[model samples]
Target: MTTPTIPGFTRHRVRVDDGVALNAAVGGAGSPVVLLHGFPQTHLMWRHVAADLAADHTVICPDLRGYGASDKPAESGAGVYAKRTMARDVVRLAAALGHDRFTLAGHDRGALVAFRAAMDHPDAVSRALFLDVLPTLDMWGALRGVSAAVGFHLYLMAQAPGLPEKMIEAAPEPFFAHFLDAWTRDADAIPADVRAHYLAASAAAVPSIVADYRASAGVDVEHDTVDREAGNKLAMPVTVLQQDWGAALGYHARGLWSAWSDALRHRTVSCGHFMAEEDPRLIAAEIRALADR
Candidate 1:
């Protein structure tokens, strides 16, 4: 099957592992930059940012594993969609593209996977940018009573057995679109076709998507715990852009982020949850700054 191509961007599928084929879009030429998309969206979320970066850098955005045109496998208990596994997929994808070391940036769910990538393969990633999310351990720890309710999806999808898969598959569009619409401060920023594509990709990958979330509640937490106890913070320069959700929820955002990295530059964007899509120029500028640093 032929993968759909976005104008001004060339699409390619590179096999990262035995069963995993990642659909990636590459453009421009200098220093590679891999952009990972968050949940309920594919690499398509990077369309605008990729276009801008492609003018100066080789912007590679991939549909993570089970999302978008990438290969999808049945949910296997032996090979769950843990962040480590997903991060490895990105690492292999970069090597396959001849990028031994590259800058990494991700938003939302992708940011979580990027975090794992930096943690597991610090040598491969030169710098890191995480948008609109706290580390998995900190996120879970931040929850308290009603304030935690904002992140209901985390707990909901982390259920036992196959309940989340079954429930989400039944009404995937609403489940996926709810966040896309609710989290954005400006709805018109996302075009109709792009929105439909996001819904389609998300709806088709229900089981794997749920597995990714479930891992966060299980294996991902274990990994983060070990890293925290070992005091293994990100060695590379780190920049975090987020809304003041911590302040809104009565927690110190800067203080929490400072605990995670020694060299940290943090900012609060006025935009809502989908910062990359809603404000690609700013996102691209921040990534460029990270690359330069």
Candidate 2:
């Protein structure tokens, strides 16, 4: 299967951990910025925004480990796919590419990783833009009643491992395509070729994908709880763009985010969950605004 990449960007396979290498598209040159793709997608989601940012900033879009062309290590232990681990992969990936620190942007699952990074390695993430997600702790706390059904995939993946992986791998393409079709505002946002690429990549990484989500249910929450208890917070300037899931879920997103970040700008956007793809210009503008501040 032919994979679509950001045009004019060069690709890199940089080793970030033992037997793990992340595939990244790197382009432009100035201050550095790293774009992390969310679940059911690869770095291709950032194609439009990355191209636009490349004019003045060095943009690095990497397929997070276990998602796209990146290596998918076994769950190994509960810690393997933890957001802490994934966040470290991001930091190491940036360091390997000659960036000691960089502005951060992540969508969906990637947003969780960016949140962990900002809290754990404050010195490494100067600013952050999180798209359409709450922190793990806030997410679980908010999913109280019927409205949580929209996140059935999370419950499915958070199961005790074997079952969810078997069920998803049984019909991987359809399973992955369900979100690709359901989570976007514009049908044309993801072109046919790009859609095919996402399905193929996601289908190929079912086990690792399930493990990643499984970690969220286990070790990730523990890590987040520790931070919350310790009163740890994000030191960087942070901007969050999200669909109005908060209203339906019975939580105040701005309040939750404000607790974690000293400087937070939360916007309730009209776009769908895949905002970077559906509204790339707005996403890019928000990233630039936060990064420049």
Candidate 3:
């Protein structure tokens, strides 16, 4: 596959762990900040935010294991795509890049992964930003009747039999592009090359990506269950930016997040689901506030 470039950032590949290689772009220089992208997107989602953050911080944005130019492996079981394993990959990636501890932020699926990272490696994450997602347990617990029906993809991909993978592979572009187009408020914000790169990556890693969603619905929820039972709230300061999905969707976003952390600051952004890509300045300001905390 041809390498797609984001202006003002240099891309590099780092071996995060066995069977996992992350495509990362590094820029600027200061306290390290790792940006993890969500579903159907690579690190390119961080283009605008990274450029500005790099001016004041060392911005490390990596395509998560199954996304972008990163290693895509066949689905074996729940272990490979579990947030624990994915979070470990990030820890190793940071250590490889000479960051023993750093601030981190994640959007959508990436936010879930970052939450797990903070839980698993508390000492390593200085601050965390969760964009547009609830804790795994809260999310699943909130799902009911129509709510569960609306999030059909979660249950669909998490099916025991390999149906979602087969279905997704059948129409990769349109299926993947739907999320890309729907999430972003501006279509042109993500350039053609970057959009194509995302499509290519999603097509190649359909199975692994499915495995990730499956794990979220299964083992990842188990992890969150255990954490909640133990009363494990995030020790580090956290900032959450999300759409008013609670009012729109019948779930209280801020109330749910406040239950998970003592030092939590939550805001409802007017942007679409893809806040980082749709509104970088707001995201940057939130990150800066989290950094200061």
Write out the backbone clash pairs for model 2: none
List pairs with backbone clashes in candidate 1: none
Per-residue lDDT for 180-225 in model 1, tens only? 8889998987788888888887898887788788888998999989
lDDT of 2 by residue, 33-88 (tens): 99999989999999999999998899999999899999999888998899999999
* TM-score-superior candidate, 1 or 3: 1
Reference-based lDDT, each prediction: 0.87, 0.91, 0.86
**Rank by TM-score (best first):** 2, 1, 3
Superposition TM-score, candidate 3 onto the true structure: 0.95
Write one digit per residue (lDDT tens) for candidate 3, span 1-293. 56565567788888877767888999888889999999888888888899888888889998898887789766687788899989998999899999989999998889999999998898899999999898888888777777566577788888875689889999999999988887777787777887888898889889888988988988898998898889888889998988876754688888899888899989888888877877899898889778766
Q: Worst ten-residue run, lDDT, model 2?
A: 284-293
Give stretches of model 3 more than 4 Å off.
1-3
What's every prediction's RMSD, in angstroms? 1.8, 0.9, 1.6
Which window of 10 residues has the lowest lDDT sum in candidate 3? 1-10
- Per-prediction TM-score, please? 0.96, 0.98, 0.95
